[model samples]
Every structure is written in C-alpha cells, then in structure tokens.
Target: MAFPFTPSRPLWLLGCGNMAGAMLSRWLESGLDPAAVTIVDPMRTDAPEGVRLCAVPPADEPAPAALLIGIKPQIFIETAGTIDALTGPETVVISIMAGIDGATLGDRFARAGGIVRLMPNLPAALGQGASILHICRDGANAHDVADALARPLGLALWVDREALIDAGTAVSGSGPAFVYRFIDAIAKGAEKLGFAPDQAAALALATVGGAAALAAASDVSPATLADRVASPGGTTRAGLNILDADQSIDSLVARTLQAASDRAVELAEMARN
Candidate 1:
C-alpha cells in the first residue's frame, strides 16, 4: 500500500535511536519515500539509504513539516535550543520521549504548529504495536498527520486527557517487558517439570503467542476462554485454582502496573522542573 500521508515538505527525525530507527524502518517498509525524510543525529550511522543524515539541522532548508523527537529525555535540555531553531509555526512536533509533558513541549517549541505526545512499544518494529497518542494541540493539521503516522505502526489509540498517556505508558509502553518476564517464568517452571531448557523456552513462547492470538480472535472475554479451556477437574482447572486462589495474580499485576504508572508520573514531574 502507498504511504497514507505525504507532507508538502520533508519530515525530520530529531534522534535516531533504537525506537526511532525501528519506526523509521517500518515507515520506509510501508512505502514512505526515503527522500522525503531527514534524520538529524550525529551518532546514527545506519540511516536508511536515500535519506539525508546530518549532525545538525540544515541551515538553508525551510522548517520541516513534521518533527519526531526521539532523543533521550535527559538530553532534551541540551538539544532544545537547536530543535527550537528548526521548528516553525507550521511544524508539527511529535515526541516519543517519556516523562515530558505537552506543556513543556509547547513551552520549548513555542512556534510549533501543533504538539503531540506518543508512547509506542517495541512491537512497533514489526508493525504490530499499541501506540497511545495525546494530541495536546492541533495546529496546521497536526491531529490528522499524527493519526496517519501512528496507524502504520499499530493500533492508534487516543485519549481525551494527556494524563492518560502516563497510564498508557505504564500499560502498553512497559507491558512487553512484563509479558517477557511471565514467559520466562513459564519456561523456568517447565524446565523444573523435566523438560529440556530449549524445549521449555520454545513451548512457553509458543503457548503465550498462541493464547494471545486466540484471545484476540475470540469474541468472548479471555476469562471466559480460560473457563472453556479448563474442564472441571482437569489439569488446566487445577492450575487455574492456584492462580485464582486469593486473587494473587490479579493483585500482583495491579501492583506492577501501578509502580510503572507512578514512575511515569515522576518522570513527568522531573521534566517540568
């Protein structure tokens, strides 16, 4: 399929770290023209062929139509002056940095046409991700442009309140790591149950992948699916009994999400300060 949106001007990626690189790769694979992109990163040596790479924003070119800020949050202060120079009244600023709030972005890029904060997971590298967006302000078609950019990477979910982005950061942004931990735990359990380590790892990975796919395809709730799988007095039921006893799993996961969300809030506070 052709790229969903084409800007009148080129899109500039401010930092090309792993997450930004993954996003750029997906966008290129989805038919975005490499010529229409520019990356400003001194350390990025692997920019896709045909895209412009510069240590600093080009001096002669007009301000970019869109700017994706993928730099480390701690370095934002050092980079803000340079980035601000490249931002014009019609440039849409999309930021993936955690902890930085819309207000701070607006303050830093006062001339930007619009501001958006996005949180995307590692799965975005494969075009299957949950991207949570908060459109802080819409100027010069920012909302539509941001949506178009997000859809190619995964499910583009928007929240009415920017605060919800922090919650989403805790859930989808940090969720993959939690899932990985659970998969490893399953593999360890399998190894303890007499399976070879490689076999246990493969089984755990496939089991989780298949179950998640099934859950997505099914119309019924996952809890209902679990019930359907666990025939009365069966092995699955016995396992479910242990997991459900005292609601231990539910409580544990709740605490985990809460901790992540709290950290996101802290990061935001630090950025503002």
Candidate 2:
C-alpha cells in the first residue's frame, strides 16, 4: 500500500543521506508519490528517481504536512534555523536525527503541531527495519501520521518514554553493525579452520541469514532453539560450551550497548546546547 500523504502539501525531508534515502526508497516502493515529496539536502547524491531535490527549503511554499529531519545531529543544529520555516501549526515534525530529544525539537519548532522522535536501523533501506518512535504531542493526528510513515519502512514500535528512544538506538539502530562484526568474526574463524576466504565469507553470511530466518519463524524462544542444536558431547555442544563459558559474550555485548547508549546521551546534551 502507498503511504497516505496529505493532498494539500508535500512531505518535506530535510536531509537525504543514507538512512533517509533508504526510507524514501521504502516509501516509494509502498506507492508514495515522488512528486508529493521535497528533499532539501546540500549533498543530493542518493535521491531516488523523480523525487524533487533542493539545496535549501523553498521559500513562499505552503507548510508541509510533515517535516522529517533526517540529517546528522550536528548538521541539524547548524541548519535548524533555516528549516524552521518548513514547520507550522499543522505540521507533524518527525526527527530521525540521533541525540536530539523531543524537548529540544519542541523548543525548536514551537509552532509545529506535534513532535516525533524516530530511531530507525540500517535494515530500513530494505523494508526490514525496526523503527522506534516517541510521540511527544499527538496534535493534528500526529500518531496516525507517524505510524503511516513508519509502516512502509518496516516494524514500527512506539515507546512511551522518550528516553527509551536512546535505548532503542543502541539495540536496533546500531545493532546491524554489531551483527556484521559477528558475521565477520565467524568468517575469520572459518578461514582459520581451512576454508577458502570467499567460501568462508559466503558461508558465514548465509548461515547467519538462514539462522535468523529460522529464529523469526520459530514459535519457541531463541534460547530453546540453541539448546535444540547442541547434542550432548557433539561439535555443536563443544562450540556452545566455549561461548557460554563465564558468559563472556553476554558481558561483551552489554558493554558494547552501554557504550552506544552513553554516546547517544552525550549527543542529546550537545543538541541541547
């Protein structure tokens, strides 16, 4: 289904980099009209076919039904004043820029109908993303509008507490890079075990992909699935034993997430200033 865009005004995207480009692609695939969207990006390298691209927000145009802030947090601060004109009392301001919380957005776009903070992961480019959103003020049908925009990208999750948006950033937003590292680690292990480099890479990627698909389809928890794989004293059991020993993997992942979450908090502070 196509996104149900407001007929009166277009959707204004303040940036069109990697994450924003991915979202636009997904929305287009969902039947969003390219003509109904306007992109204001200094670097317009990734714009899809038929979408409007502008170096700056256009002057003398109607306020957009929604304004999506898709730039980096630092860039958003630099350009916030410039794009402030794009939002109005009927516009739902949806921001995907990390580190900037709802209060900051509310303060910046005081005339906006509502403010929404969205955290979307890399997989969103492929319509397989997990988007975490926090709606600060549900004015002008903001909740439904945010849902409509997120639904086309992937799984949409609404968090009641704005702080959880940062937590989700660590888990789902930065999670893909972590998973990629794990896959590479497995590939390196395979190489050490005598597999060719190309073969190892392919095997590692396919194995992880298939395993994730299985886990998603399974009714049981992933822990149960892991147990089902290890027969007593078998090779799988041996490998599992090493991973489970002293909970090293768990501790490492915990520290990894904590670091990402902490950085997100720092960004928020920077945005506030």
Candidate 3:
C-alpha cells in the first residue's frame, strides 16, 4: 500500500548509510518523488536519479515536512546541530537509530511535529524486512504516515509502548546475525557428518531458506510442521530430541534476546547522558 499522505514539504534524510539507503531505495521504488527528497551524507557517492545529494544540511531550504535521522546513536549528539535547523513544529522526525528512545528524540528535536523510533532489520535491503515503529504521539495519522513509510520496506508493525521497540531490536534488528550463526552451525555439523565443506554450506543455506519460506507461507505453526516432517522413529525426530531436550534451545534463545535487550537499554542510557 502507498503512503496515505504524500508529504507536502521536502523530506530531508540525514546519513544515508546501509539502513537508510535500503529504506530510501524502497521508498523511491514505491513511487516516492525523488525530487522531493534530499540526502545529506558525506560519504554517500550517489542517490537515485533526480534525488539531490549533499554533504551537509541545506541552509537555504525551509524546514522539512519530515526528517529521517539514520545516523549511528553514538554520533547523534555530534550530528544533531547540523540537522537541528531542518526540523520544526511541522516536521515529523523519524529515527532509525537503535538504542535512542523517543524521550531523547523529543528532547533533541523539541520543535518537531512528532518523533517516531523505528527498528528495521537488514532484510530491508531485500524488501523482506520487519519494521517495528513507535510514535511519540497517539493518533491515527501519525501511525498512517509511519506505516506508509514502512510498508514498502516489509512487514510493518506498531507497538503501543515505546519500550517494545527495544524488545523488537533484540528480536528483529539483531535477529539476522543470530540466524546466520545458526546456518553456519548447521553447515559445520553437516561437514562433521561427512559432507564436503562447500557442499554442506550450500545445502545448509538452501535448507534454512526453504524452511523459512515455507513457514512464512504456511497456516499451521512450525511445531506442527515439524511433527509432519518427523514420522514415528524418524531421523528428524532423533535430532530434534537432542535440541529440544530440557528446552536447551529455548533457554539459549531467551538468554540471547535478554542480552541483546539489556544492551539496548544500556545504549539508551548512554544516549540520555
């Protein structure tokens, strides 16, 4: 679905790195006007045709209708002054920087129309990402605008509480790396079982991809699918038993997310100070 409301004023994007780049590319591909967008990134070499690229915030232009801050959280303070002039009471500030809370953003951009904290994973580059949004204000229009921006990127969801964004960071933002590690572990296991290194890696990758695709398309729970795959006394069941024994995998995953979430909180504290 398209954005419900097309921004009337210019949209300024600060720091067009990987995450921001993916989002912008998706927005442009979804028919957002390139002429209405300006990217401010010193290191970025180019932008989609018709979009303007600049090393610094524009001084001549009026305050933007929407400003997206895509810079790292650690450098936000250093970069805030440059983009401060571009925000006003009419400008919606959407930040994709992890660990930065809405309260901090609200304080930083006190005059902004609204503040939205969004967490989008690397899969966004492929338009198959999961974007979690948390807006400072309570209203349908704010959600609509954020949703519209997230739709082209991938699965878009909004949480009632801002704290949930950090939880989402643990599950989605840091999820890709965990999934990659699992895939690598699977490949290593296969290699130990006699498969060639390269062959094992390829098969492991494809298996995980296919399973994920199937799960995405299926109506039944993955548990049910696992039962179907493992008939009585089957090889799959044998392996699953080891992984499921004493809920080892479940506990490990919980701890993993907990660690990530804790770190997010630490980052938030750092940003606050």
Candidate 4:
C-alpha cells in the first residue's frame, strides 16, 4: 500500500532543492494532503498546488508535528536556529542534509523527539529511490516516523551504523550523477566507433534502460545475466574479457564511490567539529 496520506500531522520541509523537491512531489502525488506541508525555501518560488510556500516560518504559525531539514550541510548553521518552533520534545526532526549526524542535530534542536538522518536518491519521485536511514541512539520513535515518510519512495533501509550512511550517500545520493556520466561515456564511445552522435546516444541510453529493466525483472543475478548475454566465443565475450582482464570498469567505479564516501565523511566530521 502507498503511505497513508493522513493530514493529522503537519510537515515542514526546510528546503526544496532537486532531491528534496522530488521527495515532496512524490509525497503529494501519493495522496498526501498538500495542505499538510509548508515549504520554507527562499529561492524557490512555487510549491505543490495546495501546500504553503514561504521564505521563512510564519510568525505565529503552529508548530508542525514533523520537521524535515532539506538544506545542504554547509548551510545548517544559517537554518537550524530558525526551526525552534518545532523543537518540542514530541516533534520529530528529520534531516535530509547529507553528512550531518543525529547528535549534532539533537544538540541544535534539543527538545525534539529525536533526530533522523535520511539519505535518498533523486529517483524517489517515481517511488523507486533507495533510501538509507539512521538516527542517534535515543531516536527510536524518530526512526519510525522517518521510515513512514520515506516509505512512499521505494527501498527504505535502516542502517544502525551511521558511518554506513556516508557510504550510502556516495552510492545513492551521488550515484545517479555517476550513472549518467557512464551513460554519456557509452554514447561517446559508440559515436567514436562510427555511429551518428544522436543514434549512438539513443542506443546507449536504450541499452542501459533495457538492461536495467531486465536485471530488475529477472530473479537471476546480474552476473548470471552477463553470462547469458555472452555466449561462447561471442563478440560480447571479447568485450567482457577486456573489461575483466584490466579490471578497468570495476576499479574506476570503486574509486568513484570511495572518493564520494570519503568526502561525505569529511563533511560529517566538519559538522561534528
């Protein structure tokens, strides 16, 4: 079932950038009452049809039941204090800002029920995003609330080890950009091999899309699927051999994720310090 759209609990979304905007749109499309949300974003001019959008918290507005911080980690200092209205002990504070830990959040909003750190990818809009969740040790209720909110997106998984959330961010939060780059590389490679630019791009994109669909639909593992594609002495085998012999693709991808994860950890430390 889709997540319940009960408007009993109000939601406050602190920023509406691309990732956060996708989540907000998904929630609204999932039958959540747009009226339940109030988006606070200085630069963003619009919000879902029935939701309120403002540059700052209303002077005398009632505190929301759950507050989700969607800004970048670097800007937390500028925004954290302004969220005091919902810092009551019973209010769940969910943070989507990458690299900020729950302890730091709890310190900023000490009265909150608990702090939850959520890392989600862009694909969440289609309910197919991967979400990794975690919270401070004192945040059980906060975790449940966060999971409830994230469930509208696909594949919400809890990670007790907050460090792993950084890994998740690298693999999921920044992962889409990496995937797109790989698609672009594929298209360029195809073009270099004589296909027209547009034709090469179309085939490269369709190949990725079709391959992903097959992987998702089949029970067989991707490794086995590769075997299925590469029949003995086939052209696919020749290409596979080159990739495997040099370990080029896997090594490059590993390095990419490692770099992203390290940066996330660095950001986490910066926030902690």
Which one wins on lDDT?
Answer: 1
For model 2, residues 1-273, the per-residue Cα lDDT tens digits are 756574467898988888888898888888888888889987875467778889878888888988889988887788777667678888889999888988888777877898899899878878889999999877978998889999877899999999999999999999999999999999999999999999999999999999999999999998899999999999999999888999988989999999999999999999998
Ranking by lDDT: 1, 2, 3, 4
lDDT of 4 by residue, 1-273 (tens): 444334566788888899889998888888778888888889998887989999977676556677889888888966667675556666778888877876777778866777788899999999999999987635536766788889998889999888888899999989989989989999999999999999999999999989988999999999899989998899999989988877887998899999999998888789888
Cα lDDT for residue 81, model 1?
A: 74
Model 2 steric clash pairs: none
Clash list (residue pairs), candidate 4? none
> Residue 142: error of model 2 in Å?
0.8
- The runs of at least 3 residues in candidate 1 whose Cα sits more than 4 Å from the true structure, single-residue gaps closed, are 1-8
lDDT of 3: 0.84
Residues 11-50, model 1: lDDT tens digits: 8999998888888888898889998899999887767888
Off by over 4 Å in 4: 1-8, 137-140
Which of candidates 1 and 4 reaches a greater lDDT?
1
lDDT (tens digit, per residue) of candidate 3 on 177-236: 999999999999999999999999999999999999999999999989988998789899
Ranking by TM-score: 2, 1, 4, 3
- Residue 184 in candidate 2, Cα distance off native in Å: 0.6
**In candidate 3, residue 159 scores what lDDT?**
88
Give the runs in model 3 whose Cα sits over 4 Å from its true position. Answer: 1-8, 138-141
